[model samples]
Target: MTEALLELKDVYISYLGVEAVRGVSLRVTERDFVTVIGANGAGKSSVFNAISGLVKPAKGEIWFNGERIDRLTPPQIAGRGVIQVPEGRKIFPLLTVKENLMVGAFMQRDKKKIAENFENVYRLFPALKERPTAKGIRLSGGQQQMLAIGRAMMANPKMILLDEPSLGLSPIFCQQLSRQLKALHNEGKTLLLVEQNARMGLSLANYGYVLENGELRKEGTSAQLLNDDEVKRAYLGV
Candidate 1:
């Protein structure tokens, strides 16, 4: 088995006397594309929040690349090469497309390296290159989502936490996003994706975890979960 690049052990998170995640343990192997699929309010985003250091866990541990990270600040975590593309495509609407991408490089000091990353991002999404001066608010929803992913990539992350990348996209756009995600995975980027679109998520991932009410209900190879009767009935509506 491949060594784990990211691991959570018996993690618990709470907010205002309510527990959002309860004793959840999971792992993502190096360079693996892993997906977490669950119903809304199942605490999937809460898990990502904790991973990104946006929410502190009340109990347990988070490990990345053999070091503990649960106590780190969000910027600290990003500095350690863990980045997130949050839900809702939270692009800076008032900023130009290039400026918004530049925000991702706040931690880096090497201007030349940052410029190289920007060029790579523009290469990946040529539409952004064509509209570098366009305000983010003027882009289509799909373009905004692309910008979000591109922004995260600009951080030079070792592992990216993606939350609902296909949430509001049409089928064609979702398919396009899935293809891009697969391409990233093929290039050996580790990914931990939380997605509501079970069919697409499972199809792209090598391993899959099912979360329900903040608890990890099941986990296995993607093919196993995809063929499982209970998983199909509950999540895939098969």
Candidate 2:
């Protein structure tokens, strides 16, 4: 069997002395699209932060490509191709679209590879291609989200951990974002997404884990979770 591309072993996170996450574990295999769905304060972003090495776990381990990475720094983990598109579409407000994308490739040394990544990002987000010089702050909400994803793509990541990609998008933009994400998955990109939009998250991912108050409340194939009565009532508003 193929080893998991990413795994978290009984992880725990704390803020000051307060526990934010408690013994959460999950896995993502190659080419898999996985999602974690929950309400606000469910510790979804905290988990992504731990995976990105922004915040160290107070307990447990994180493994990527069979290597223990819980002890690594943020840059070290990012160097290993685990990139995160953080919540709130944190693109640089003053940077032009192309400039913002180039920031993601700062670690790359190959000039040709950087060019190729630019091409790929533009292709994935034609709106960015059309306004390559526009300041990031000028882009609409959907476009900013696109730029955030594009920036992460510029890093040539093996896996992307996206935190709440659909948060404030209009229904139309959400639909568009969903299609773009699905296209990325089809192209063999491994993704781990966290979202409060339960229906959209579950629909897009093949496998899902539900988080409730910083704990793993449920885990199943997306189809299974979509049909689950408890999940329906609590998350899907069914």
After superposition, the stretches of candidate 1 with alpha carbons farther than 4 Å from their true spots are none
Candidate 2, position 222, lDDT: 100
TM-score of 1: 0.97
Alpha-carbon shift of residue 75 in model 1 (angstroms): 1.1
TM-score of 2: 0.99
- Top model number, lDDT: 2
Q: Report each candidate's C-alpha RMSD, comma-separated, in the order given.
A: 1.0, 0.7
Residue-level lDDT of model 2, residues 121-173, one tens digit each, is: 88889999999999999999999999999999999999999999999999999
Instruction: State TM-scores per candidate.
Output: 0.97, 0.99
Model 1's lDDT to the true fold?
Answer: 0.92
